[model samples]
Target chain A: MSSINSSGEPAAVRVVGGWASPFVNRVVVALKLKGVVHEMLQETVGKKSELLLRSNPVHKKIPVLLHHGKPIAESLIIVEYIDEVWASNGAPAILPRDPHGRAVERFWAQYIDDKIPPGIRVLRGSVAQDKDKAAGEMSTALQHLEEAFVECSQGKQYFGGDNIGYLDIALGSFLGWIKAVEKIAGVELLNEAKVPNLAAWADRFCAHPAVVDVVPDADRLVEFTVQHAALLRAVNVPK
Target chain B: MSSINSSGEPAAVRVVGGWASPFVNRVVVALKLKGVVHEMLQETVGKKSELLLRSNPVHKKIPVLLHHGKPIAESLIIVEYIDEVWASNGAPAILPRDPHGRAVERFWAQYIDDKIPPGIRVLRGSVAQDKDKAAGEMSTALQHLEEAFVECSQGKQYFGGDNIGYLDIALGSFLGWIKAVEKIAGVELLNEAKVPNLAAWADRFCAHPAVVDVVPDADRLVEFTVQHAALLRAVNVPK
Candidate 1:
């Protein structure tokens, strides 16, 4: 392998993604957390790139991490792959070292996956009333997560204990979309009053060096969401 | 494993689950594959045991494997935990040896998890037409999975090559559920003609020692589904 590049990318490693996708952001934060420099290939939204299709033939979704031309797909799956491949490269483990600890982190990560996406789908629903209902549901979810963070963090700054980790990346990657949802729906989420601790944690997570740069711009995500929804309506693609 | 029980379980390991949950079967098969004899605690449907609630407070779901009094939840995640904890005990790996191989297997496992559950949900729908629609979708999914088997199995007997691996357990756990769905919906799934290879694989998978006993009886599962649906309607429980 060649030397690391200025962008902190490792030679021969590449990520196929879209700029506004939180799923793609997951890969970026993972690479950055590992201090690895990898080339990024931005694919257009709603249109699959030949590289992405070839890389992830099964799902044909983005956030495919290619190492030495062999591709791995699924955002969290790619993050776990990165952790394994680079475990010996002096990077801290993305998952916890102990099996039970790892299992705990994985459980929370899966919880985030299960909870967040459905709320986002409702946020993207056609009716403003539905968005409000979704926002309320997401608020309750955040309160539970605040309790979870307290249990998992052990008074540390982050879920990985003073650093970003699997669960942090799992939830934090949605910072931009969360923002866009609040703006478009005009409803508060990650409710500071109800989930004050988690709301604070969200701030620290987004401001962390690993996440600050890679997260999609909130305004851009808002515009993209609005345009994409209109385009979906125009084309009448089945949801 | 306390000299290995005739039932094939490990000591100090307990599986809190239901008789008919495909998710629970995944744990049983994985444990049996490793020749571990874990205790079983069967929880009634529509009821939560104190142990299950305490072990998995967040989701309050079943299939929690308690090892040495510590709990791990989620079926596949528990499987991975089992693989890691028992890695040095001479059992073949449930996941692959290499990271890329592991990633590939993980991808397919995620695909199976994504594709199977929704079909089951639709199978439980109030209307027969919705079940038919779901069966059609699932049949198409099986066709794709058949293609995946060709790519993954490489003429071997199973997805993990010589034995069942992550993807195998992921989909294989649902064999009985597929049967129940077929019986209840009155339509073919895992369409033998369309996905002949996967169809054959299912027969061999069900007959395997690790799976044969653990999979819930098909007739029992159908009965459970009908009863559970009726119970929900009686109680006016939210879907």
Candidate 2:
């Protein structure tokens, strides 16, 4: 899928990301949506790579898209870059053309970024003392997300209406982890009964060809979650 | 400054913000830079306005830009909207025209958002036990910011090279607060010896005509800080 730029030269695209990271998957899904060919360099947890460190010295985190050897960090920013760069390549529009619609999409994306971690922590907690409270908070967060889906989707299949866009990729990357979280917590956080729109949206998102190709196997994610549950709980313990 | 759209109707612009909020000032500066006319609705901290609540139902936060009765929340997002909406209005460019440059600006803006809060917490801490540690962390954070300015500015007057851009607006909004924070914490965070480039950039940013028009008075900010320090410290105290 390497294409000629305005200079009539082939475009160089590469992504340095972690396999298990939802943030990384966001970039992968976006690239696939744009039909851009790129190499993915997997980064190992607990060990930093020279290229990753060189590319993103400040954050030193994964999901760095190296476009022509220049790195762009932060998953959302990278996704926006992909959308803008590949905009005229006949790829699907990830962001709305109008400023207001784009801003709305960005607002929800940032909300998801801020809200999802706590929900994940709720599911990660193993202690019975915190279970109920955590679950309550997680449920409230999920409900807020459901409301967002309702408002943005507005009787459509996705947030951008009739297609997967920025918000879908941002939140949908968590499909595998949400499944693992539900099983570990033994609570149905998302369902047709609770958040019908979000549940259906998730199903549609997971079934997308691009999403299907990038999302990690559900069983592998579950196994990883079980193995790391104790460590996650230890880290999430109240200070 | 109202202009007719394609429909031949005047644009209605309103800003719901607080006097002492750095986030609010960001929008104010952007509007001033874009030469857009906007009514500024000052929001009382303890009492949010009906307009704010109605516009930003999810976050219910200030610095919401109401354009044609539609509300766009979040400071950075609002700035982007203002820039995009006024792109052809011939105002000075707040963001770079090129995709790569815009992405770099956004990457730093996000960095500023993530790094500045911890520094603010350090300044808000009342106890001496945590002051040194917090100060150390803040200094490290500042150093990282300084590195960014060096890389992005490349000896230019601003992050966008001789012009105040998105990053400048984002980080420059905190200049007054940084002054208050330094006085309250009894440490100079930005100086000639350390982060000289950022210090100079802050001076240039504050001195800009648009920034001068919107920035809260330094004395007023200091007084406000002194008044709110105790309340802020109480909230900042870790559980």
Give DockQ for candidates 1 onward, in order: 0.82, 0.81
lDDT of 1: 0.81
lDDT of 2 by residue, B42-126 (tens): 7754566777888888878878888988889999999999999999887878898888888999988988788776676567554
In model 1, the runs with Cα more than 4 Å from the true position are A1-11, A124-129, A226-229, A232-239, B1-11, B124-129, B226-229, B232-239
Top candidate on DockQ is 1
Question: What tier of docking accuracy does candidate 1 attain?
Answer: high
Question: What are the Cα lDDT values of the candidates?
Answer: 0.81, 0.80
Error of 2 at B78 (Å): 0.3
Clashing residue pairs in all predictions, respectively, total 10, 0
Candidate 2 chain B worst ten-residue window by lDDT: B230-239
**After superposing candidate 2, which stretches have Cα over 4 Å from the reference?**
A1-11, A125-129, A228-239, B1-11, B125-129, B229-239
Residue pairs in collision within model 1: A8-A37, A9-A37, A9-A38, A10-A37, B9-B36, B9-B37, B9-B38, B10-B36, B10-B37, B10-B38
Worst 10 residues of 1 chain B by lDDT: B230-239
lDDT of 1 by residue, B1-239 (tens): 24345666554888988767788889989999998877888887677789889998887887899998889999989999999998888778899888988998888888888878778766755333476678878887888788889988999989889999988999998888888878887878877788888988999999999888888767987877777886643432111
